[model samples]
Every structure is written in structure tokens, then in C-alpha cells.
Target: MSSAVATVPGAEHAGVSLLRGDGVITSYTPSSSTVSEVDRLQSTYREGPCVTALWDQHTVVVDDLVAEADRWPRFAPEAAARGILSMLSFQLFTRDDSLGALNLYSSVRKRFDLDSQMLGGLFASQAALVLAGAQESVRLHRALATRDVIGQAKGILIERFGVDAETAFTMLVHSSQNTNLKLVDVARWLVQGRDRPVSS
Candidate 1:
């Protein structure tokens, strides 16, 4: 994905960053020294075009870093020091459950024009699709694991208390609610607890 953006006419550097639902940057790609520095600054200070793009769910274009000093107090100066004169950040994905950004940087001001924005946006959409697919795969895997653990927990309850399946499930649910933990967590606890010897 970074390579795709790097091919843009005036693009000097490009990076794709994934942000967790809480707005913390989780991962980024194509490790260039300067680009990695910029990514780190944004994640550390929590300000920059990329951060804005992720939060607002839109593209953020900076024509000149020097001119945008007030907008991003700490980021603008640091980015300029690294010879980044301009940047374009597209919101790669923004859903209730996910967020991500694709950022392009250049040494010359106004490097990304309309055509570049459109092409970058297209790339961003592709990134979004990939992120969404990956997230879904993770969700499905967790769901399967949860089901397996919960089933084991239910079986244990049934054998120990001589209860029906529905009653055993209810017990799990009650435990989950009482502890304020997820049903899956509660079920996992029950399964692991069996390994411990009962106290005399």
C-alpha cells in the first residue's frame, strides 16, 4: 500500500498507519527513517494530518508545513525539520469498529494536487477494504474460539451440577454479568479453573 502511494507524481514518501478504535496507532508500514520518525511523532503527540484524518474520517491536505504551524503545534515544526514541506493523509478506514490512515509526504509544498488526491483516495479505499477483511477474519476466529470454550464450560457445569444445557449456559451468563467480564472470558476462566486443585 505504501508503494502504491509512493508512485504518485510528486510523492516523496508514503506510509500506511493503522489506528485502534481508541485512536492509538497500532501498526505502520514501509520503514523509511524520516517517515518512521514522522509516524512516531504523530503517535506520541497524538497530532498531525494523519491523526486528524483518522479522527474526522476525511482527507487532510497540508499545502505547506510552515504555514500550518498553528494547526499542529508540536507536529508542524518537527515535520518541517525533517524536510517534509507538505503532506496528504487519507482516512483509509473509518467504521464504528475500526480506523486507519494513509499518509503521503513530499519535500515541496503543494505537491499533492487534485489528481493526486483522487488517486490517493482510491488507494485508501483499497486499504480500507483490506483492513475490513482482516478485521472480519479476526472476529470470526475469536467467535469460533469463544464458542469452543463456552461449550467446554457448559459441559463442565452440566456434569458437576446435573443441569440441562440451557441452565448451564444461564450460569455462564450470570457469572459473566456478575463479574462484569465478557461471556467468553468467563467461559475461559471456568475451563482454566478446572486445572486448579480444590482447597481442603
Candidate 2:
């Protein structure tokens, strides 16, 4: 965010917005409290340059929020009241499913120019890659942890019930279905000794 403010002319503050897998929007690395407030407004209103860039276009440059009041009826007035007049937002992802947006804010009308847009776009691309990689790492780590727990659960079932590996797995699946719990949850329960006998 500091780099964005330094590199992008007329950008007084910067923040990153992320759309989580659960469909919630979150803010990260806000340059200041004012930037955080702006991001919160965007999330609450669901209508702003950052939201528009994330959902519709690759880039959204608002030279003056007052002039674009009709575009974002609820968000524009609120943001302007906070002393933000111009904004430049770039979609972080280039793919069909967007990750989020990188937003730059300014207090002066028509603050951002063509040069600012170009620089911000480049920064957004790099930020997108970093965010994607981090997300993938977290997913992989969770998958590995789940696999290990399930394996331990299967071992316990095999030893206790004198069943083969496949049979133990089937028993776990049956218990998951009977209880309407997730397979992972069933396995975790057995591993933790919360449940002894498999339903099947």
C-alpha cells in the first residue's frame, strides 16, 4: 500500500480488497484509517469503483465522485463526505473468476491521470499473483491436514473393528451419511475419540 501511494501520482491512500471463497468481501493492507473506511463503505453499499472493477470491468477510474453521484448513488455521497473525491480501481485477477481489486484514493477532484492508471494496473497484476499463490498454499495445507486426520481415523477403525482399510473407509462414509455430517467431520470425531463405534 505504501508503494502504491508512492508510485501512483495523486494517490493519497491505497488498499486491497479480496472476495473470499465464502462470498464475503474483505479489506487488507489499507494505507490509512480513511482508506479502511472507504473499503468498508464499498463492501456495505456493494456499489463503488472497487466493487465495479472486481465484478464488471478490469479498471474503473472515477475522476470526481461528485460528478458520478448517479453511478454509485449510495456510495458516492458517503465517500465524498469522507473527503475522497477521486478513485482508481483495478481488478486484481485477469481470469474469469476475479480475486478482488486494488484501489487508490485521492482527496482532490481529477487527481488520478492516465499515468496513474497505467502504474496502478501493473501493481494490481503483481498483487494478484501473490494473493493467488497464498490462497493456493492455504488450500493445499488444509487438504494435507485433512488427509492425515482421515488416515489416522481409518487406522483406529481398522485396529478396533478388525476390518480392512477399505471396509473402515466405507464405515466412515456410512457414519457421515447417517449423521448428515461432513466426511471430514466424521473422521475427525473418530480420530479425536469423540465417537467410538462407526454407525455402519
- Candidate No. with top TM-score: 2
Candidate 1 lowest-lDDT run of ten? 191-200
Model 2 per-residue lDDT tens digits across residues 4-85: 9998999999999987665566888899999889888988888999889988998999999988789999999999999999
Model 2 C-alpha RMSD vs. true structure (Å) is 1.8
Best by lDDT: 2
**Residue 137 CA displacement from its true place in model 2, Å:** 0.8
For candidate 1, lDDT tens digit of each residue in 42-154?
88888999889988749998999998879899999999998999899998766676678888889999999998888888887887788788888999998898899999999
Model 1 residue 165 lDDT score: 96
C-alpha TM-scores of all predictions: 0.84, 0.92
- For model 2, the stretches where C-alpha displacement exceeds 4 angstroms are 94-98
